[model samples]
Target: MLYVPFAILVAALLFGVPIAFSLTLAGAFGLWITLGDVGQVVEVVGTTVFSSVADYTLSTVPLFILMAFLASQSGVARELFAALSSWTSNIRGGLAVATVGATGMFGALSGASTAAAAVMSQVAVPNMRSHGYADEVAAGAVAVGATTAILIPPSIALVIYGLMTETSLGDLLIAGILPGVLLAVLLAATILIWVRINPTLAPETYPSSWSERVASLRGVWPSATLILLMLSLLYSGIATPTEVGAIGAVSAMALGFALRRLTWQGVMIAVHQTLRASAMIFLIFIAAKIFGYYLSLSQIPQMLVTWVGHLAVNRWFIIVGIIAGYFVLSMFMDELPLMVITLPLTFPIIVSLGFDPVWFGVLTMMMIAMGLVFPPVGMVAFVVSASGGVALSKVYKGTLFLILSIFAATALLMVFPEIALYLPALVRGREF
Candidate 1:
């Protein structure tokens, strides 16, 4: 029965099994029940293992992940934060605002939100605290800022969304650009408002000289050049996502060496990290694929879609319900597993409702981003807490306002779907 596999999944997760194993075992159980043949289930697993991760487009995962680690090793986050901070130093809550800017810039290079949050925690939290910024405000800014990576270009989250849903990968990546920028701006504005409302949260500081600010800009060129190069190739349609990822990875390495910031040891570490992360992601992919096969055989998604169509309520109510469900589940689960597990069911339902897949994909990704900073099991919050030595309570407290910003951004996107879909349309128009 459909209920049994899901019950098994919940039980496995409760018992502290690894997510990959949990998904594989639960899915295998469902297959054995439906097919009534262990050999058939074994056959499904064997084929899904090879077919799931073998796509050429999936190469984008490891390459972008490699670029992220290499960029981290090369000190991209440190320099970008320093440069942005110089410009914002005189403003109230300047360092925190700079942290948001630096996070957005780092998002251009890396697709991993946790990595962005961790790096910024190390680079920005100390300066903010030293400058009299509240621990909650500093940690909150870093955590929420990191969420931008999932909406920005070269986002691994979007790529995985595209691959799973059979949407246009390039469109999905491009679709995130405007929404990402909007979220970053809203976050910055929210910081300013919070500081204005409670001046004690951020004390004013002495301004930097023009010369000092100008000099600081020099620190940003390496990242600027890399961002520019990657965007040009991607927006120009000059290369595939895989090729762009490869170019970005190699260029990041070159910039690291050219600056003498990256050593042989650093390169080794990057490679090792990339391998581990990639393996984890692909394993999820394989498991989710098998789970998907089981779902198709069960026809659960098809049944749900038909059942929903027969309802008398309006569709937006259904949309809200689905989003509410995602928010709840995301609080308890990681992003990738959540996406892979639910998309197989949700994607078809949205399509049946006649909504655009790309739009829904962006919406789903933004929700997942919010989860990254949410309370309890929020991965980004934990990263900021551990890496910055901020109290976990303070980190959660800090994210409170920024989480509101995420909700606001999601509302705007819901009202005006164009916010997430405009650029992707250009891609369809051959303007990419």
Candidate 2:
């Protein structure tokens, strides 16, 4: 039955069917084969689709999606980048470094890599190019930096993973903060090192006047306040992740209104974009639930757990192998679909190896972050390249170092589980 569903899924994908449809078709086929009753298929599909979307935890998806759209459309990202660049522009490769810092902040608000890439590319890439930075360096900076968005607080990916695995969303959200900052700081350090080695890549500029710097900071206060408000609300337990996202969306709109940038056209466009993204994600969730149901019936997760339990190697090695598999799979697929499809299988293995599910969720997120800069199918890479009008090859060259930095970060998290666990524990208590 598993083989039949897997084959059908593969064929559907090969035939260019959308992943959501492919999953649904595969699940329906499995049900037909297993039950030999066509009538039951409708009932199963209805139940799965309804239950998946009806989940209270799933509410975070649309809220975050709407917040991202509002931020993008309200021009908050541009203002934030401008302020960061003014402060950091004096140092060698400073603007590029600032781009990473700015993107990390925006990542906290948006929590979606593609949104971070798209917004930062439009705001920072041209500014860096104007500052005489290399095209590869500028483009690569935005592409790789944007991946941090997913590892930052209020992350939609972490929220989804927590919901699927029955882990605390708050734990997953808080766990991401330190690692996200580490990745951004490391990337900035890497850029500084590279610029020092090859001065020709990024020419240094004189520092701006004190007045100029002070005035520039004034322009970005809205963004800063928004960040503080959202993070404080989440950390203080004043609001859930979804509520924080809602607050962010409303705050962005208010900021835009105060800045006179929230035109009617922009509002309509934001709404349209938010609806489209939300619909797509909801569909994927429904399809994955259906497929997961079929896999459960086949007892595949249990079987794989038993097999892993019988292995002679150290459990950590098996865990590493699973993480490596996710990395490889991410190269050919989007994170959402790949996560939805693979977690059902791989998650059980991780549990059997006696790893903390929250820690593994953070680990999984970092692996997906690496995928954002990986070649061919890396969504963030494509977004930054297209938006910045740079060649993909150049972006790839520039991101290579950043990607390695992310891998190093992943290794640190894997080796020192406390890094991911400590914040969650500190904020949520030991019971988490």
| Index of the highest-lDDT prediction | 1
Off by over 4 Å in 2: none
Which digits, one per residue and each the tens of the lDDT, describe model 2 over residues 76-165?
787778788888888998898889988988888788888889889988889888888998889888988998888887788898898778
Instruction: Give lDDT tens digits, candidate 1, residues 101-215.
Output: 9999998888978888888999999989888899999999999999999889889989999999888888888888899999999999999999999999898675889999999
Which stretches of candidate 1 lie above 4 Å from their native place? 430-432
Clashing pairs in 1: none
lDDT of 1: 0.90
For each candidate, what is the lDDT? 0.90, 0.85
Clash count of each predicted structure = 0, 0
RMSD of each: 1.4, 1.5
